[model samples]
Target: MLIHGLLAGSLALSGTPATTAQAKIDCAEVKCLALTFDDGPGKSTAKLLRILKKERAKATFFLTGKYVDQRPALAKRTLAEGHAIGNHTYSHFSLTPRLDDEIFDDIKAGQQAIKKATGLTATMFRPPFGHTDERVLRIADELDLAEVKWTGTTHDWALKDKKKIKAKVLSLAKRDGIILMHDTVPQTVQAMPEVIRELKKRGYHLVTVPQLYSGKLRSGVSYP
Candidate 1:
């Protein structure tokens, strides 16, 4: 599966197995997973945060500059509440075929804005559309950032079905995995509480991305 290859090549350096390996980690002491929501700072973003707090969980939010411009306070709120903020580029128009300099500029612009609003500098970048090539990786390396991606998604932005959202999350979830759900969709926010509940029932600890990878605070970017 695409996720298996992606996780093997990108996240783990020491041959960690795929999502099916969750059982061992799930039973491990202090089991953890990274929950990342992207392309956000939308109206639903705050609601998503509320659900996360009720679950007593945290997540990383990759916020686009366009959304930040529209909802600057929401972006600040994300940081204020201790969720890591990441740059999702300014326009999020497209990263494909763009030169390295252009992509870096876009990411930096996003970084500057978020820093301005929240006194936080984001060290994670999600290339638009999950489109990453050698150039994208190089730019992330140059900027001292990590390229963040996801293992499974409900495609909630496309489908509004809450049942499908919860099912997809549970179906593909794994310990220490980065699960992608978007903050722009109400259905996603609606589905997250149950998702967290199920993960808790199954003995998974939801962690920030940096914690998932490095056992550190979510200040810098990281993979898991």
Candidate 2:
């Protein structure tokens, strides 16, 4: 998927407490960015979570159903630690090319898998490969999910180089920006510590997608 045309804007923080033990920050008054990971609660994810915990940074994970089934414990731990979760569809298929029923079934299955594993329904959805349209949005709305698109992406799965992935993420950082990366990418996981450090050094609060929007996300609306 291409990363382009990122618009600058601010969003409100949800009533949920900030991931850290410190005072909650209002995105409207402070610089905030939401870091989102898509695909896999894979083997590398446990390490990623430890890094985030150490850094006191929070993120949002969009889980694919197949992987969630394979790593249910990790999914539960992810939620237990205060990061937000979202559905990335059951099989990670590009949604626009699929029939309406096919699209609905996949997304619904994703919801079920996440619920079965974590016991909490996801309030967010992101279409695989960033392939989404009116129909996908409609179905997501029906499923009570707000569609989330990234403001920028590291494309770390393709880059594979930790240094390059870190550079891409730094270049994309901005107020209220939502950055896309993948926990399944080992190199990306390796790069996250320095990425989190630099973002904090630059005075940005790392937040979940819901926290970035102040927890008032509208169903079917595509977000920043």
Candidate 3:
């Protein structure tokens, strides 16, 4: 909760444009990890927020348009808590096998939905189902959003056991790694504390997606 305390002691930020509201993360010389949750702003998201706060960790949420529409306040809170937001498309549709124009529209819709819900723009995009090709990269490049991929996945969406989720994530935790997870899963939410504590014990400075990239993310680059 150190970052949360730091956030309170620092300047007050409101739900404003991203340029004015984004927090500057300082993680120089630290082993940074980017915890990214996809298909979220869901029923279990608030609990995830509490866990992140308890861990004093910053994470990134790749939200779908409809989920943001369902829980706008959660989306806003995610940004307000000094976390980053990214587009996961409007319908969580797989993009690689889809039409290029359709993929573009979905990404745009998700971006607009995020801005509407959080008063911040998504500077990153995670392809739904982690399916991407040259066309997906092109669309992301055109939108000026960095394409973020993960180095490890907890498989929390398919796995129902919290212990397994914790084990998978902890086993794969590494420096400068982006972890793919989901906020919609309750077990994953439950597994967070242990995973965070162990990672912290090992000296990882959990950070947001942009913080992991130090704001120098290359366009169309798939960060791990």
Candidate 4:
């Protein structure tokens, strides 16, 4: 009876959610790099997932609620294939200029959408265009989400050149660096294969955002 009680207590302490028990990569033993994509589950995302699978790489997808509603299967697939899903807002609007209530609603809606589709609530969020302030942070805290930012980016949204995108990511790759890209961009999809290859050649481990910063995620704090 005492052994059973101890086992049940351990389970209770660990939380009853599968999301909480997901395995994480040891970033300390590996040259970890988090490849995070925002504004997606879009047209190019399926192909992006294929590339990631082919490379045996993992990533985090920060999905807009509108798109999650439109492409639920893709969002679900991201979770199915062991990638982390994060909230990128419902409308993908700039949170910096919005009212606190509006920001809170959009963020909450995004979380609800992901939960509805994937059966998992996102513990991470990245504000649209990396914009956020105190109000945004407070609302995120209420939602139990950690605000994530990027350590580097390919600037692929503005640039259509695939080679430049690949080169930029390679140049900026570092230990435990978070590389921001958009899965909605076709050029980004095109650039991802080579970038994955080159990053592997340079001895970097591709991991999700949570895996890259395991045990360090704090609500309301922005991780760069």
Q: Whose lDDT is greatest here?
A: 2
Better of 3 and 4 by lDDT: 4
Q: Write the per-residue lDDT of candidate 1 for residues 1-224, one digit (tens) a residue.
A: 11122222222112132222222233245667777888889889988988865666667788998789888899888866556677898889677688778888988888778877776766677777788777777777777677777877668788888998889888887766788878888888898888888887786766556546552323233343
Model 2, 1-224: lDDT tens digits are: 00001111222233322334323567887788989999979989999999987777778899999999999999988877777889999999999999999999999999999999988778888999999888989999999889999999888988999999999999999999999999999999999999988988888888778767767798988986
> How many pairs collide in each candidate, listed in order?
0, 3, 0, 0
Q: What TM-score would every model get versus the actual structure? A: 0.82, 0.90, 0.87, 0.88
TM-score for model 3? 0.87
* lDDT tens digits by residue: candidate 4, 1-224: 10112112221112221112234346776678888999998999999999877667777899999999999999988887777788999999999898888999999999999999988878889999888888888899999899998999888999878998888888888998998999998998999988888887787767677767665687888887
Cα error, residue 109 of model 1, in Å, equals: 0.9
lDDT (C-alpha, whole model) for all candidates:
0.70, 0.84, 0.78, 0.80
Q: List residue ranges in candidate 1 displaced over 4 A.
A: 1-28, 215-224
Q: In model 1, what is the error at residue 200, expressed in angstroms?
A: 0.8
Model 3 ranges with Cα > 4 A deviation: 1-28
Q: How far is 3's C-alpha from truth in model 3 (Å)? A: 15
Q: What tens digits encode model 3's per-residue C-alpha lDDT throughout 97-206?
A: 88889988989999899989977767788998789888899889888788888998888888889999999998888878889999999999999988888887787777
| TM-score between candidate 4 and the true structure | 0.88
